[model samples]
Target: MNPNPLKILVLFYSQHGSTLNLARQIARGIESVPGCEAVLRTVPKVSAVCEAVESSVPEQGAPYAEADDLKHCAALALGSPTRFGNMAAAMKYFIDGTIPQWLGAELSGKPATVFTSSSSLHGGQESTLLSMMLPLLHHGMIISGIPFSESALGHTQSGGTPYGASHVAGHEGRAALTDEENELAFAQGKRLAELAVKLAA
Candidate 1:
């Protein structure tokens, strides 16, 4: 194994864990690539009231993301639980705070991908994926997505899309990812990792 592996950031926000599940699978795919590592991070929740402040460390799951995380990552995978037809406000708020990276073009030429989880089958997974891509695009990242060649993309009954990998969490919003969803997510990450390694080299 290479002592210094390329770091692929898997950054996301999840309220009920479905998005987190996707992140885990993506990490698996990233690490499956030799000389690459998955660096998982997450953003804190947003509050309408101005007084709210999240602790420097998260209570559970991945560590909260920092500007330095962006600075060092070779590539990125952004995930969120869908809010209406967009990413969660917490994830949006975090992206908004990434002005330094955008200004410096720190993410330029890197391969990036997006993923999401939604409360229902029609709950805007594709739109959510697209929304996340906007910031990455502005940062000059090359967007990578799951293709029809992945097979799961062609036959998935629930929650896989060419735009990105996604999960249908049902109305109550906590369902596990179906087999197809998991497979596609894994493929998405693997594809992105391969691309990122090639680009970084």
Candidate 2:
């Protein structure tokens, strides 16, 4: 790890690969900023039945995100899949559990941005991003978004947005991210990191 890197947490819940892809892109963006580090994490799946269970640790990929990780981060990049114009249940479940962090103002004044992926072009990507911002707002995180100045926003025919970063994964949800989408996601990540470092200074 680079000494004095501004650690930014990239947290999400991705049942499918699209959200995970977006997370990876955002992490790359975060790493582009000098002296900023990206710590990727994910939330555990919630079972339908009360007695159903999952392993304490995930079987693969990044480890489950701890609440303390949110508290200590200098900034955050939140991502989730769209579920009826809302965020995924697993992601919502994780955010709801951060009451302690909110009460303590752990994330207050920190920069935050959100991203989402959906099957349809009109699949409510913007709403999903906005809804995710609600909890972060309660925590007093300053919102960050991609400005139109990024060329990707003006030219993308697929998934790029001003709300943050988004991708149109098609109905099958297996489409590779377009070059434009990837560029915008990286831009968003870099923008957030730059803002965080400036605020810290």
**Candidate that would win on lDDT:** 2
Write the residue-wise lDDT of candidate 2 on 81-198 in tens digits: 9999999998899898888898899999999999999999999999999999999999999999999999999999989889989989887877478999999999999999999999
The C-alpha stretches of model 2 lying farther than 4 A from their native spots are none
Cα lDDT of model 2 overall?
Answer: 0.91
Local distance difference test, candidate 1: 0.90
**Local error of candidate 1 at residue 200 (angstroms):** 1.6
Model 2: lDDT of residue 192: 95
> For residues 139-174, could you state the per-residue lDDT of candidate 1 as single tens digits?
999999988998888898889999999999887766
Worst 10 residues of 2 by lDDT: 47-56
